[model samples]
Target: MKIATFNVNGINGRLPRLLEWLAEAKPDAVCLQELKAPGDRFPEAAIRDAGYGAIWQGQARWNGVAILARGADPVETRRGLPGDPEDAQARYIEAAVGGVLIGGLYLPNGNPRPGPKFDYKLAWTERLLAHAAGLIEAGVPAVLAGDFNIIPTDQDVYKPERWRDDALFAPEAKAAFQRLLDQGWTDAIRALHPDAIIYTFWDYWRNAFGRDAGLRIDHLLLSPSVAGRLAKAGVDRAVRGRDKASDHAPAWLTLRKA
Candidate 1:
């Protein structure tokens, strides 16, 4: 099975680009972030025509998440992250597709740090850690895949020093990512290309994509059982340079079918 994740930026505005990619890449499953549309406005007809069934947690003009399964309907699992009843952002969604539990998330950006937004980001990650632990204990075949909005490590970005002050690369954020790895989730792209300088996102300004200045934020982290089947993984970097493209390229992994 080929599983992929993409931060579409704006689903309604970018539907054409997304549809084109879906036709060409043909991933068996995909997790999408940044829908930037309300629940009632999701382009269900277009996606259905593209031959994928999807379930989404939609919000207006900010954050949203969705899971799409090629040729089948995704069985809805969960709508939001646990441990936060008051939190109402549409940033997390989960579904069962082809017998695998897939968690799709769009973690908070938390820019202009040292404030409430940054605090929320940290707290959100804590919640994620707790839930991820449960998933690990259950030992199900699963994947946590999405735009994590985290740089993870110096090796995961180009010119790390330039982003040191950024929230995505902040020590606290990186530590949270480490805690997830400590729980035994395998970072699929890193596992496949341990020493490569792989990246999934590039800023639109300053010719970042042209100069190969990018960051590896979007990711597919696998539970142990699912990790064992990992065969190949990579970023579709070319997609980022296309006309009317999103800043993020699709990060994908292929696993052996049982």
Candidate 2:
């Protein structure tokens, strides 16, 4: 099965580009982040028309996530990450599609470090790691995919010096990201193309996309049960260059059939 993840930026604004990519890429399941729309406003009919059904957790003009399955309905697994009772951002949603457990996430940006937002980001990462451990212990083939808002390593970002102070590249943030991998999850893209400088997000400022100045924040991390199935992984870099495209591109993985 093929699984894909994308931070569409805004579903309404990027519908055309998103539909085109969906048709061309044809992934079996897609995990979407940053829908930036409220539940009532989700464009369900439009998504269904494109031959997919989805479950979405939305908040207008801000964090939101969804899971779309082609040719089948996704069985909702969880709505938000456990262990944070007061947490309310629509940043996480999970589902079971075609026997694969998939999670869509839009981790906090946590800009301007040494602040409350940065603290929240670290706490959120901890919760995710705990949840991930639980999933793996259950013996399910899981794929946690989306915009983690983290630059895992120097290789994952261009011009690492420029991003040193940013939350995405902060030492604490990178350490939290590493802890996830240490917990027995495999970074699919790195496993597939370790030496390739793959990037999933390019900022609109400074003509980043045109200059190919980007960061590999979006990712697909697989649990041990599914790690062996990794066949191919890539960033649809061309999609980011398209007209009215999102700052982020689609990142995907192909797994061997069970």
Candidate 3:
């Protein structure tokens, strides 16, 4: 099975490019983030037309997440992250596709450090950590994939010095991401190509893509049961160069059939 994670930036605006990729890539399963549309606004019919069934948790003009299974409906498992009753953001969605659990998320950007947003970001990580531990403890074959929005290491960013104080590069965020790895989730990309400078996101400003100034923020992590099945992992960098494309390209992995 092939699975992919992409932050479309905005689903409605990028629908065409999305559909094009779906057709060309033909991923068995897809985790999409940043829909930037409400639940009612999700273009379900169009997605279905492209030969995929999806389940989405959308928020107006902001965070959203969805899971798509080619030629089948994703069996809904959960919506939104747990551990915070007061907090409400369409940033996490989980489903089952072809016997594999898919956890798709759009982790908070938490820009402008030393503020409430940043605080919320850290708090949310704690919540995610708690829940992620449970998933691991459950011993299920799971793939946690999405735009984590955290620049994991100096190697993952083009210019670490330039983003020293940025939230995505914040020490706390990186540490949290590392903790997830310590929990035994395989960072598929890094594990497969340790020294390669693979980037999945490039800002439109300053000709970032043209200059190859990018960051590997989006990720796909596999649990122990699924990690051994990983046959190939890659980033569809060409997609990021398309006309009016999303700042992020799709990160994907293929699992060997049992």
Candidate 4:
């Protein structure tokens, strides 16, 4: 099975680009983030025509998440993160696809330091860690995949010095991401290509893509049961350079069948 994650930026306007990628890449399962649409306007028919069944959690003009399984319908598992009942953002979704429990998430951006947004980001990650621990204890085949909005390490970004003050790469954020690894989740792409400079997102300004200035924020972290099946993984970087393309490219991994 192949699993992939992408932050579409805006699903309605980017439907064409999205469908095109779906048909071409043909990932067995895909975790999509940043729908930027309400639940009612998800374009279900268009995606259905593209040969996939999907379940999405959408918020108008902001965050959203979905799980799409090619040629098969995904069995809905959970709608939101567990720790906070008051939190209503459409940033996380979970489903069962071909025996694997897939957790798709769009973690908070948390820009502008010393602010509420940053505080929320940290709080959200703490929730993620708590829930992830449960999954690990259960020992189920699971994958936590999506636009984590986390630059895990200096090696994961273009300029460590430039982004040191950024929320995505802040010490607290990186530490949270590290805690996930410490909890026994394998960082798929990095495991496969440890020393390689791989990036999943590039800025639209300053000719970032052209200059190869990008960050590896989107990721697929696998539980031990699923990690053993990792065969190949990479980013579809060419997609990022296309017209009307999202700033993020799809990050994907293929697994050997059990």
Candidate 5:
């Protein structure tokens, strides 16, 4: 099975590009983030026409997440992450497809550090850690994939000194990411090509993409049961250079058949 994650930026505005990538990549399962649309407004017809079934949790003009399964609909598991009743954002979605539990996430960007947004980001990470531990203990084949909004190490960023104070590069966020890894989730891309500078996101300004100034924020993490099946992993960097493309390219992994 092949699994991929992409942050489309805005689904409606980028539907054409998204469909094009889907048709070309043909991943068996896809985790999508940042739909930037309300639930009722999701373009079901467009997605269906592309030969995929999807379940989305959307919020108007902001965060959203979805899971797409080629040739069939993903069975819904949960719409939002637990542990926070007051928190409401379409940033997390989980589903079951082809015997694998997939968790699609759009972690908070948390810009302008030393503020409330940054605090929320850390708290959310805590909740995610707790829930991820349960998934690990459950002993199911699972994947946690999406825009993590984290630069795991200085090596993952093009210019470490430039982004040292940014939320994505903050020590708190990186430490939280470590907590997840300590629970034993395999960072598939890093594991596959250790020491290589692979990036999935590039900003639109300053010719970041043109200059290859990018960050490796999007990720596909595998549980113990699924990590051993990993065969290949990569980033579709060409997609980020396409017309009307999202800032993020798709990060994908191939698994040996059970």
Candidate 6:
């Protein structure tokens, strides 16, 4: 199956661009982040018309996540990440498509380090780690894909020096990301193209996209049960340059069928 992850930025504003990409790329399943719309306001009909059915966790205008499966309706396996009853941001949604578990997440962007937002980001990462441990224990083939909002390593970002103080690439953030990897999940993109400078997200400021100044924040992490089946992975960088396109491009991986 061809599985992809993309941060569409905003579902309503990027509908046309999203449809165009979806038709051209034709992935079997897609995990979307940053829907930025309420559940009632999601363009369900439009998405259905595009030949996919989705399960989404939505907030008004901030964090949101969804999983869209082509040719199959996704069965929701879980909603928000557990461990924090007070946590209410629509950041996580998981589902099963043809026996493959897929999860989409929009991790918080904790900017202005040494602040409350940064603390919340770390706490959220801990919660996600706890939840991921549970999923790993379930022993199912799964892929966690989305905008993690954490620049994992120097290789994952354009310049380590430039992002040193940035929240996304902070030492604490990188450690949290490493903790996830240590849990027996394979970073699918890195597994396929270890040395390639593949990037999936760029800022819409100061001509970042045009300059190829981007970061590989969006990712597809596969459990060991599914990692051996990995066939291919890539970033649709062209999509980031399209008219009315999102700051992020689609990152995808294809896996051999069991």
Model 2 regions lying over 4 Å from their true place: none
In model 3, the worst 10-residue window by lDDT is 80-89
Per-residue lDDT tens digits of candidate 4, residues 86-133? 999999999999999999999999999869999999999999999999
Candidate 4 structure, TM-score to reference: 0.99
Q: Provide the RMSD of all predictions against the true structure, rounded to 1 decimal.
A: 0.6, 0.7, 0.7, 0.6, 0.6, 0.8
lDDT of 3 by residue, 1-258 (tens): 999999999999999999999999999999999999999999999999999999999999999999999999999999988988878888899999999999999899998897998998899988888888889999999999999989999999997999999999999999999999999899999989999999999999999999999999999999998899999999999999999899999999999995
Candidate 6: count of backbone clashes, pairs at least 3 residues apart or interchain: 0
Which regions in candidate 3 have their CA more than 4 angstroms from the true location?
none
* Tens-digit lDDT track of model 1 for 1-258: 999999999999999999999999999999999999999989999999999999998899989999999999999989999999999999999999988999999999888888888899999999999999999999999999999999999999999999888889999999999999999999999998999999999999999999999999998999988899999999998899999999999999999986
Go through the candidates in order and give each one's C-alpha lDDT.
0.94, 0.93, 0.94, 0.96, 0.95, 0.91
Candidate 6 TM-score, true structure as reference: 0.98
Error of 2 at 88 (Å): 1.3
For every model shown, what is its TM-score relative to the native structure? 0.99, 0.99, 0.99, 0.99, 0.99, 0.98
What tens digits encode model 6's per-residue C-alpha lDDT throughout 1-258? Answer: 999999999999999999899899999899999999999989889989999998998899888889999977899999988888899899999999877999888888898898999988988889889988877889899999999999999998887799999999999988988888999999999998989998898899999888888899998999988889999999999999998899999999999989
| Candidate 2 residue-wise lDDT, 35-68, digit = tens | 9999998989988999999999999899999999
lDDT of 5 by residue, 1-258 (tens): 999999999999999999999999999999999999999999998899999999999999999999999999999998888999888989899999999999999999998898999998998888889989999999999999999999999989998999999999999999999989999999999998999999999999999999999999999999998999999999999999999999999999999997
Weakest lDDT window of 10 consecutive positions for candidate 5? 122-131
